[model samples]
Target: MVIKAQALAYFVVKCTFSGPQDLTLDEQLIRTPGIWKLFVDGSVAGKKCGAGLILSSPEGFEICQAIIFDFPLTNNETEYEVLLAGMKLARSLEAKHLRAFSNSMLVVKHFSGEYEQMDPQTTAYATKIKDASLSFGTFELSQIGRENNGWADALSRLASAKTQSLTGSIYLTEAKTPSIEKKECLEIRQGADWMTPLRNYLEKDILPPNRREELKIKYRASRSIIINGRMYHRSFSQPLLRCLNTEEQYQALEAVHEGICGEHLAGWSLAFKILRQGFFWPTLKVDASEYAKKCVQCQLFATVPRQPPEEMTSVLSPIQFAMWAVDIVGVLPTSTKQARYCIIAIDYMTKWVEARPLSAITEEAAKKFFIEQIILRFGIPKICISNNGTQFNGNKFRKFLHHFGFK
Candidate 1:
């Protein structure tokens, strides 16, 4: 009976009803080979902030790391920092499949795309996390209860603690700056150009092998001198002007044309200003002209030309009263009959003028004045021109024009 029970227990242990599809996500992941689990937690005590991370491999081996922040950061930022640290550690280990857990709901939600990140700092952190996630074949982040994340929570609190009384082995790290802040390094390369030959010839007495080029450099070097390691061109009537390279030419033009105390002068004026400031380039005038033209502010606020582009021609009426210009001049001081507006008509060729006063400038008043003062008195005009006022452009005025056969 004892041997039968042992065989039955062995058979039960070997048999499984649940297939891979029926297994929970965590169970499936646990059974997968080469998968890694990450748990991260962040803590803030008083003014200090810190984070803790725990990474476990499929074989059940674990690595723990603690981060002490030297800079001030909020709890949410700390959570993101710890997560990012975990991701870096996994990537360094070449872990292909990663599953991360965080006790902070905000961090998880932001990473999972369930919540919008409104804070600029956190948004930057999220973008960095997303970019880093692409390094792994499979990456998952889920929210867990703080109680369930006890080991990471304890490690985080330990990081914030002043004294560590109990510890075996943990990688303690210090973060001097926020991860989201980027440090930019700019490399300036001064390549060979027109100034390079002159500089080489002047500084080291180096000259080209060609006889013609050698003679040209020798002749040009006569007027150019080196002062404090800088080449300068000798001016007959002015101080020595510093010769500039391609980059320096651009800088000089920008400073003179649009820098602080810049007057936004024209192209030629800009080149002269730079020359007055003791700088010279071969294409200074041309470059200055192009740069000034390209300036958005200069183009936008440029003065408009007052004169017409083409030759001026006078418009002549073939006969008197054939062409008339009608206009309204208004809002004057009250005069007799409480008239505060005046409607006037003029003959284009004869310079004849007729005027009428109006209490209100309206379509009806304009029609009556035009009919009695100009049309009936002088006959219907072949052409009439007026400012685009409602009284002139209204439907009633248009119908009156159509009825009179006026263009």
Candidate 2:
């Protein structure tokens, strides 16, 4: 067998302060008549500080040296992540017929079929360890009491000492701490300039001369420039401005402007130039109506229905959380005692009803009720059903749901 197994052997999983030299003498004993299992351990002490590990066979064949780092302000959860990272490295080395040992009862127990309440980070690490074990083909992990784990403890202390040495400079300097916000601010500013070249390209004459003149006329008329057969106007003003030299840019601008002769040219072209450079057309969510609306000929010829068809009316689904029915029952009489109206939310599943009384049947009052009363009580339903009531149709309510995590 490529891997020899001894019937009886001493397997010591130890945490120690003794360096690799301590294992040199024990090398052959580990490979002697019987087999030996060895585990070494250590822990980190400070910021960027970490523990270390040196695993050798019982007879002292070198296995691995691993480092475990810690952040001063971190919790057990973050420490667990560092531990898992260590295990993942070991697994990648393809250790087989192996045993794992740790001073961390939480880590050892959770890994060895012990069910203890673990934070999400630990839980995630445990899952990964199990997955790693399976990928390694065969392995066993066991926990040993500290008394039986002396060598590993010493090694953990050594690792802490090493970490202290490495991070010693950090202790002396106030500027050693990295700035997280500085990188973000740099990225934002750099991103703005990154688009500058693109803006110049657009302003420099990307548009055909004919299109530019058409756009100029549209600017004068305060209208959109729609080319020969397209629904959306291809903006030419900003494209024209990006091509301008510094003198042209300095003479005038609000994105676009009216000439002395009242002829329109690119004014706020500078802003438009930037915009054109950084332009990213959002992916439009298309409904059948939107496509039809965009068709100029169809839009002009299509007749509006006298009233919306009953079938076209949105109906709340039968599933409770699947959809919600909302409507403002209004035209309430103005009275101090009686509320002017109410916004009602009906659950499609439970058929439960929630109502918010409104003073003036105003959109604001209806919205406040929907948020404070309906959403707060029942949670945000996947879909909301509301009639063509002014309150429901207002832009505010749509923006509210969008701002929240809902979708």
Candidate 2 C-alpha lDDT tens digits along 285-312: 1222243344454456556689756558
Q: Candidate 2 overall Cα lDDT vs. reference?
A: 0.46
CA lDDT, every prediction?
Answer: 0.78, 0.46
Candidate 1 segments whose C-alpha is farther than 4 A from its true place: 1-28, 170-172, 182-407
Residue 7, model 1: lDDT of: 14
Report the poorest 10 consecutive residues by lDDT, candidate 2. 165-174
Residue 364 miss distance in model 2 (angstroms)? 86
